[model samples]
Target: EPEVTQTPSHQVTQMGQEVILRCVPISNHLYFYWYRQILGQKVEFLVSFYNNEISEKSEIFDDQFSVERPDGSNFTLKIRSTKLEDSAMYFCANRLRLATDTQYFGPGTRLTVL
Candidate 1:
């Protein structure tokens, strides 16, 4: 079966540099989402995209963050400036629909800032 894949399973970055976390979602999936888990916190939704535009986004998706489908299969999330608080596991997920959707997640990109 096809699955979502994320790059650099673990990333260590400086506190002020930019980072682009990459993901390749399932080929036939229609909806894509970005979520982050801070060590002991709940998974927080960042953004959701479909049809090449943002469908929904949470407050966590601020000016420093952006996402794009750079190609047919690759989806990317860019953080303009990282912060120490940005350390977390960033997960990429995809599903077939918005409501009643069952999403599949990548192993996750662990971002470490120092």
Candidate 2:
């Protein structure tokens, strides 16, 4: 079966640099989302995109963050300016629909900022 794949399972970056986390969602899904977990915190939704525009975004998705479908299969999240608090496990997920649908998450990209 197809699955979501994330790159650089762990990443360490400076407090003012940029980082791009990559993901490949399930091949046949139409909806995509990004969520983050700060250590022991709950998974917080960042944004959800479909049909090439943002469907929903949480307060946590500030100007510093952006996402894109660079190609047919690759989805990427870019943080323009990182902060120490930005460190977390970024998970990429996708599902066919929202009503009664379950998201399939990637292994997660752990970002560490110092």
Candidate 3:
């Protein structure tokens, strides 16, 4: 069995700095997504990407945020400028195929903005 992977399990950064979170989804999954959970808060959807374009996005994915699939196996999320409020655990998820909606989630990349 295969699973999603995220790099730099933990990250610490100063406010106004940029951060890029990386993810690798399951080998055959077609739908990819990014979600975030602030400490003590509920998990929130950030954006969804398919076929190299965005399929859906939440308000949280504003001008400061961007996502890209730089290669066939890797997906990335970039935050242009970090804020204290941006501190949270970011997760990556992917669905096996278009026939099903089931998504497998990655452990997560924790971002701490000071």
Per-model clash counts, in order, read 0, 0, 0
| Model 1 per-residue lDDT tens digits across residues 1-114 | 888999979999999999999999988888899999999999999999998889999998999999999887898999999999999999999997556879999989999999
The TM-score obtained by model 1 is: 0.95
- Model 3: CA > 4 A from native: none
| Local error of candidate 2 at residue 49 (angstroms) | 0.6
Of candidates 3 and 2, the better by TM-score: 3
Residues 8-62, candidate 3, lDDT per residue (tens digit)? 7999999999999999999989999999999999999999999999999999999
Superposed Cα deviation of residue 8, candidate 3 (Å): 1.1
Q: Candidate 3: lDDT of 30? A: 93
Candidate 1 vs candidate 2, TM-score winner: 2
Instruction: List CA RMSD, all candidates.
Output: 1.2, 1.1, 0.9
Worst 10 residues of 3 by lDDT: 94-103
Total backbone collisions, model 2: 0
The numbered model that scores best in lDDT is 3
Give the runs in model 2 whose Cα sits over 4 Å from its true position: none
Candidate 2, 26-109: lDDT as tens digits: 987888999999999999999998977889999999999999998867888999999999999999999976567888999999
